[model samples]
Target: MQSTISYLWHTDDLLGQGATASVYKARNKKSGEVVAVKVFNTASYMRPREVQGPGRQKVLVMEYCSSGSLLSVLESPEHAFGLPEDEFLVVLHCVVAGMNHLRENGIVHRDIKPGNIMRLVGEEGQSIYKLTDFGAARELDDDEKFVSVYGTEEYLHPDMYERAVLRKPQQKAFGVTVDLWSIGVTLYHAATGSLPFIPFGGPRRNKEIMYRITTEKPAGAIAGTQKRENGPLEWSYTLPITCQLSVGLQSQLVPILANILEVEQAKCWGFDQFFAETSDILQRVVVHVFSLSQAVLHHVYIHAHNTIAIFLEAVYEQTSVAPRHQEYLFEGHPCVLEPSLSAQHIAHTTASSPLTLFSMASETPKGLTFRDPALDIPKFVPKVDLQGDYNTAKGMLGAGYQSLRLARTLLDGQELMLRGLHWVVEVLQTTCRRTLEVTRMALLFLSSSLGTDRFSHVAGRPEIKELKEASELRSRLRTLAEVLSRCSQNITETQKSLSGLSSELLKNRDQVHEDRSIRQIQCCLDKMYLIYKQFKKSRIRPGLGYNEEQIHKLDKVNFSHLAKRLLQVFQEERVQNYQAALVMHGQRMRMVHETRNHLRLVGCSVAACNTEAQGAQESLSKILDWLSHQLLQDMTKGVQTSPPPTDPYPNPEPTDLVLHMQELCKEMKVLALDLQDNNHVIERLSRVPTAPDV
Candidate 1:
């Protein structure tokens, strides 16, 4: 599969396009078999040397399935969103069998969306549905909670669904349970022919579904016949899997399948167990379903596993090589160190290579680097804006997480407490900084056109006083951000104090110091958690504020607001800067028209003099030429322009026109000066251009 592009894969035809990547049909020049190739559009790995992550260079590839996704086949009008009992079993059996193949190779398909599962067409008859889009799939290692939320919306499992909404990356300790959740979602989707948790409707439906995944119970839709007493207001569906699937396949898949989709994640089956039962039923269901050949099924399994293994290995390899003192090594196994280093260093460093025993050190290593002192250490590195009222919020949160971990260790022994606290100050302080950065990043993201939808919440009650409370809405977020900032500052200060005291305590070996440190860490943690809860609650946006009456009363206004926000996003400052000179040029042209009209309106015949007329004509003509050139420049450079009829004004004032022209001239001068300053900044930031040293 890796050696050649199969015939089924054609780059010209698009198989799919999603928020983060695009898939195309492409054929291997050497292989006649068809295949699907997905090229990720994420920039995480695409940044220049300073920013690139592992796999940034690799283009994801998959085999082409002729049958499209099982999702499309089931949802198409021919089926009307529900497959016949017999046929549904066939599909289930095939999918499980395919999944079994993947598990055998230690691969878990993280994203089991219907769109990702495809069918292969055969010359003689109908095709076998093959799973594709292995981009999110990963190999099974040690049992660990999964991190990183990546998947299609309609098919996301509860865990990923929750994390994505919260915009938090899960710890890498994730295991096969993620795959099971996806499988459950896929099966549920197949049965109902609709998304699992979300009701198809307004735009906010997605966010609501995400929130539910995080904080709410499983809706009746996926919960089956055990209806929630809360009743009709809640969205629920019966157990579509048991009802729609055949008895044989159901019996085979039910055990592990139930575990995969368990409401309680801890109960879910891992990849190994899921594979065994699935492999046992492959033969029985393959013929009844698509009559898929054993060789192809095996190929799918082998290929998926190998792909995951290679990719994961690649990620680990790249991360392990990062500067040990500065990098967090993300969420994977900490690298094995050579025996030469101290046991403590070995436990800490992510370096994978082993060293000889002679290299071990008894105390702090001389060559090891410290955090940059110039950056004020923790003060500058926090994810939250520490300057705000919530400055200590993040520190409090860090202390909280540390305190929780410290509970087990502190109870273990007094010596252990001392050892752990010594490390805790360093680790927690660092973590606090990173968390601050992440939180600040999230806020920046939120500030940048990330939120604003109010209709999704109030579709049924737009005129509700709460729904129309814009000031209230802004206040909620503003208060949350402020709270977060304050908490972050407190945390930072506490961390700084901890760091300063650590040297003295460690040197003196004081028992009292150890106890105080533990208490401080615990207190900080409690505060951080409180702030986080507040932040999470603030996520309930303007969309959910409306009741049925308000929705009906102010639907138009809500929609208008939504539209305005949408337009304003495109009209943001960065975009404006990109086309600033051109926009100014156009404004100047309008001013020329205004100036001519103003003179005409007045008795003064400014153009009556030949010199005046020539000057006015030349000035207007030069400005026009500049406007045309600027537009051309923007188009050639891929800068954005307003759409046709997007002009801000149709009838500008004559005086306003003259004023705009003058403003344009002033703006051009300022722009030139700014450009010069930018050039200097760029030069300062860049490495000096130098000849190679001999």
Candidate 2:
């Protein structure tokens, strides 16, 4: 009897019993259609196979069939194939149609035997055969091997029985011909009412069946012969339809079957192709379409960002405004105007207010719009006609907004670039450190070896030989190491200098924005006017009397103060120069000491290896000449230029003071002359050190 379980089809009654599994009839709660749900015995049956292997885990779900198993149908006296032509044709067509659907969807009903097929009886009691028992069904391409012989003995393929069930790792290709062969066997069985390759009621007849399928010729040679003769034919003893199909239509089957019965154990066709051929109804539903949408969004962002950057560049150039590193706001500062007397316009006429007050303060307004309390900006500035070119202003503002967006993007890109640079520099530093350590080790080994006294035993005292070789190669190694070290240092210093320069660029930008020199000049002009007004009020004529004398006295006082300030400035400048000189002197001394030490080491090393007297003498002479010209000349010149101290220690003659004065005067005169000549010499020097083209 059929039973209901929520919305699913189920059975209250058991349909069949087996050693491994049990089948029951079920009814759909909504449609009341019958279905068979098979419950597998967990201990007896192996698990559902994985793509890699098999275990006992799979259960079958089926549909109820009133006509029972194909085996039972053939065994009954009335239904057994003493073969009525129409009945045979109908059964063959039903089997072929179901198999075709499975194959097209890339599913393999690997076990296609009589016991597995069931015939559904309609309300009118007419039987419609359908393939069921999907428990043994597997994806055709699954690599996992199911070890057990799964179906009735007669339908097993010869190759499947003989060969390993699991495909080898190297086998990438498979076709649907294996399933077709099983269908052929099923067709032959239905017509003959006997298992094709095996007989029943024999002693363990499965082994004989396996042998026939594997090695012996199939009993139905006539079937094969008839199929070859007909071009393409079905196995039905009575069928009007032809079995021939186009190659393209046939090619579509493998992937189709692979989809539905997709034994996940195998390489199954993806859902994309499965749904496409499921039916015309399901073809409209698309899966996994978001990938295309994301690509489109990515493209739009890049294009919009680029357009914004170009617009910003154009605006910055046309307006003669340097691109601001920080955000810009036009509404932060507002303009004010200086008061004008005898003005017909701009003055507010109030009967209660004094005309003189209006005349006095008419030059500037007390307040205006768009002022920040944090910043001290001028009350007045020259204003532009912002609304005059509304269209142009609109265009420029649009461009400016674009620039702001692009600037943000650039900031992010710059951060990434800086991070990349940091990583690269870190790697370079690591490499340099390793190289230095290796060179140090090599040098230590060389030094120890070259100190050897051995003469003939080179191989036994290889360390000594190595040392001698190292001594010979020391100059080349030192030169190469120094060159590389200098290059690395230069790269580091260049990066540091670039960082400093970038900071300077920002500083310059701030300075340009904050410049109020023009406003300061106007303030000064106003102050001068105030002084003039005071002078006029006092009736102080500059050309006559006490007023002129007082003014002249004030002017002299200002001049004396200015001169004193100038002297103070000069004193400060001299102090700074002295400190700078001391720094330079100390640096130079250290450099000289290091150079001398390096030279002494090299000289002693060469002397130790001086087997040739003439070569040693020539090297010494060249070294002496280089030291004399380059080092001594610069040192002596620096010493000569330094002045004597001002502190007096001994009772000296006034003549000493006189001589000191004379020396100072003479040196000043020579300094002036040198200064006159230095410009031309510097120009010549600049032109002389031209880099050679590579």
Candidate 3:
């Protein structure tokens, strides 16, 4: 290793070696510019004095073509099939330019093969293939001929192969057209990754057979034939699916291949023609090719005036996937191709990224997709106006659920409230009515005791209302009725504040009812229960000695008012929550109505695309069906218009075919038609020609 002059060089870092010179990678010390040096084999020592004596100059740092030689690239697993149309163009441009320069200076490259070609990365990141290893090249005119044969056996022309390999005694001079054959073979290997002609045995061992295969073929027929070890000859014209060339590029390339792959000297295209064709393709057309799977690939051509519709049509033609079946995506979101958008604009916008394709049947296509960020399916995005509704729906549903649940709990307690009210009414009726009956009996007894048959109680039945005690009872009844009437108010005692209010109720215990202890309330209830236990004992006890204390306790608690208050509490607790649930339910219902309206926009988008695709399918089907029907009608007319066979075999059905010639009793009739009619007959009959059923 040595760092000398203006560059650092390493002896072991050999780039490549040939019969004349060996190339090495080097770097300039001042500028740190990397370059490939082509040093003559004998001139191993560096001499920076002269350019011809071979001290090559480095202008700018060039990125080494990590792809190595064309041969190594073809041998790679990815290029096992070969270079696609785009990369193939790079090779064509470089070789044709190099060849043109060499030929213009009266030099011929006798050896033009994959190994002799080298590549470098251009400033634009495009591959720049260069024709290198010019050891076998020499100065020669177009008409001048050379006696010695050179080049790889597989890529060599038949004349050279026969003279060199077969050791033929005859001498033949090869002209400059020999290089054209080698270039043809090289281009074939570049595009397809294999030789154009092959046999069961190797090229050198099967010398005579290789010669016959090459020479016997017609001019410009570039189909490749390969003889397998145990199988028959396999000839193929279509390039492999792995070749990532666009449809436009492949179409342009086939003709170039045909013109150059010819054996006849007069038929091949010159370097001038090759350069123009490759240059036109590289500058004019912009085609993008995509691979979907191991087997499926598509090439979509883009142009200035083309629309999205035009672009999809090209995709459909190449991939056989219908537009409806294909789902394009951009930046990880579904890409809805806009019908009116310019395809060229989209292609340019997405030129830096790879595009991915998905089948309608796939859950979602993955990996990559090329799509413009601005492109979308119209109205597919969520509407901002409706977002509020969507966001609020869940809260409404939850609130409604809680409200209804609370209403159910209150309802479950309703049965208990009704039962308590019925008991309170029974207690009130039994005690009050019995008190009046006993007082009437006492009044009658007093009236009989007196001599004058007069009673101390002087008031009549209607006038009993005038008594102070009666008035008092009437006032209590009126208060209970008024309180019961106000059902909406929360009249029940507040359990939380009852402790503070209990002292007040105790101070005026006769007037105000407090929630007494269970023992106190139970004593009153038990006294009433005892009366009902015995049939005779169940009679009303009222007045002075009729269990007065028990009755007074029941009276003070105001059972009737408590029952009404309890019912009011139950109704009040449920009504608020139940009504709230309804309101929330109403909110959700309105949301559904609004959502349905938004869904119509989505449905319209779907329907339009579906209808368009269906219309196209229906149009094609209708045309095919119409054509079939027309042919059938024409055939039916022809069968009817033809003259009847005289030898019908059965002298009956005149239009029938006569198959039994021996049974025919008369001669057959023949019809002569005009030239135009004959052509029409041929056309009409061709549609229904007799064919074997598979």
Candidate 4:
């Protein structure tokens, strides 16, 4: 059956078919890229009936391997027997690398045999080997162990065979080391063209092979021959007719196989130990370092078997410099180590001398400063004062409300300014808290680092003395923060009280306005009634005589309608007044709250500054006393040239403290001015004339 999956890949050439799945060569219609797709036969596998349905078959898509499996290559007469040492080494390295990656991800490829390894042809006609068929791969849990026997019989570890035979409940479980045993068997087959452990008995061969694997030791030599060496006869495996390999290659293979085929699992060499033992097969490279002035410092050695990216990492760790900031030079010419470059290729090309590396910042001292021409200098924007904005809003609102257009303009402008002020207050509060945190940390660090004796010598210096004075300034800042905090609290409380007062005032205003509207309506109705009565009286006289009762009834109905209409208009006016009052009260309350938050933030800043100042003051006092004692000792030793006439231990007045108080007073004066201005505005508002009584 043929089908297209994901509307991108179409199944075409059939690759192979297995018991559980069928492999097909698929191609991407849009990209024209080829891939190997394995479609699992759900019927063959034991799955739940509910999961077994048409179009629900499991499928896996993978990158296509141009060359077929290693087993196919090994079985072929032309290539199977006579593999060169270098080609064999390449295959071994690739498989080991793949296994290392699996181990890193906590996976075990239990069936690591020749059938599962595939070769791919590169653009340059180079062969690259890759591990495939993860059907037997298992992800191990932290405490998990494998007990059941799985994988091909010949490649299985002796422990697994033993466990399967004994069928004991208390048998110890195996781990990823079993896979290493399978690798040993695969490598031996690839090198010698035969299985190390051959089966014998027809029906009971499986158990017989397991017994030999458990009891017998691996052959010590590679020639597959038995010879008398010294006192005992040693058995060895010789390469088959087509399996012509180098003595060096055979020597390397023998020890690795012996280690992996060890009876004890703990004695088996792991991936890390294997890699370390075989690292000499990989290439190497050298990196050199030089300063901006072309002065050489040191050189570093790195492996040239990986990509250029990996080499760059080694460079960074060696020099303690970031890769981005390093500039590589080869033979006085700049060279960029692109990601695509092969580490082995670069290492071969690099001269006997190391490649020079210089930091980007190094060029600045060589009079080669370069700035980005595209960047423009930024211009500073001046901050807008909320007080000024408030004044402008108040001025606009005070402009006569006779014109509806002007009234709307004033309201919108006032709202915009209020929003800006609210945002500014929030930012200020955050800044104050951050500043306090920084100051506290600095004071703690200084207190911990400097001793009492050290403080005296340090404080004696002019620069240090200036810093001490600055600490006093910080005390003033602290006081300012406290004042601001108090002001904020006061403003918040005042705003709450004012909000209640405004609500009450609004209710009173609404009642008065409603009463006046009703009174005006009643007066108008009374006048209309008088006019109707006159008209009726005139119609009743002499020649114009009419029904007086009818006229009276008509007048009553007209008055009733007029009264109803007037009441409705009055109620609408009352609603409008109530809404306007609420809007004004809400705006005023927000303003007060914003101001309160700003003051609170300023208070936090002051408190932090005060704490820092207190720490500095105590430190300075101790220093001064120490200095005085030191001076007295010098005088007793006749070391004094000219001294002050005052007592040696005279008390020095704290001028810094006095100055701090003065600064606080100055800030208080500014606050007082603002309060006075607010008081004037309140008085003006109070003087506005009220509506006359109905």
Best of the candidates, TM-score: 3
lDDT of 3 by residue, 562-633 (tens): 323332332353444333433432333233223323323322332232233223323323333333344355
Query: Which segments of model 2 are wrong by more than 4 Å?
Result: 1-12, 28-33, 51-59, 80-82, 123-125, 141-149, 163-175, 199-203, 206-210, 218-694
Separate clash counts for every candidate: 76, 32, 5, 9
Per-residue CA lDDT of model 1 for 1-694, tens digit only, reads 2223233444558777776667777766774545667666764343233222354545666766756778667544224334554555556677777877786687767778777778766687745677776666666654544555566654566556656644656653456666677777777666645444543242144465344542354422243321233233243333442133433344454555455666555665666676666565554311111000000000011112233233223323322222221111111222333323432332221111111011001111111111211121012122322132122233323322322332322222323223323443444345445434433443343243114432222223344343244334344445544544554465466556556645743653453334344344344334434444443343343323336324322432332233233223323421232234233323322332232233222212111221222233234334533533543455568775344354464434334434444454444344334334433432332221110000
Single out the weakest 10-residue window by summed lDDT for candidate 2.
Answer: 289-298
Name the runs in model 1 displaced over 4 angstroms: 1-12, 30-34, 42-57, 123-126, 168-172, 199-206, 213-221, 224-237, 240-258, 271-694
Q: Which digits, one per residue and each the tens of the lDDT, describe model 2 over residues 477-556?
A: 34433543444354344445435534543553354345343233333333433433433333433243566546634533
User: Using lDDT as the measure, what is the rank order of every candidate, best first?
Assistant: 4, 3, 1, 2
Structural similarity to truth (TM-score) of each candidate = 0.35, 0.28, 0.40, 0.36
**Which candidate, 1 or 4, has the higher TM-score?**
4
Question: Arrange candidates by TM-score, highest first: which order?
Answer: 3, 4, 1, 2
Cα distance off (Å), candidate 4, residue 377: 86
Clashing pairs in 4: 81-242, 222-237, 223-237, 223-238, 224-236, 224-237, 224-238, 478-606, 481-603
After superposition, the stretches of candidate 4 with alpha carbons farther than 4 Å from their true spots are: 7-12, 29-32, 42-56, 141-144, 161-170, 201-207, 218-242, 283-694
Model with the higher lDDT, candidate 1 or 4 = 4
Candidate 4 overall lDDT versus native: 0.49
Cα shift from native, residue 207, model 2 (Å): 0.7
lDDT of each: 0.42, 0.37, 0.47, 0.49
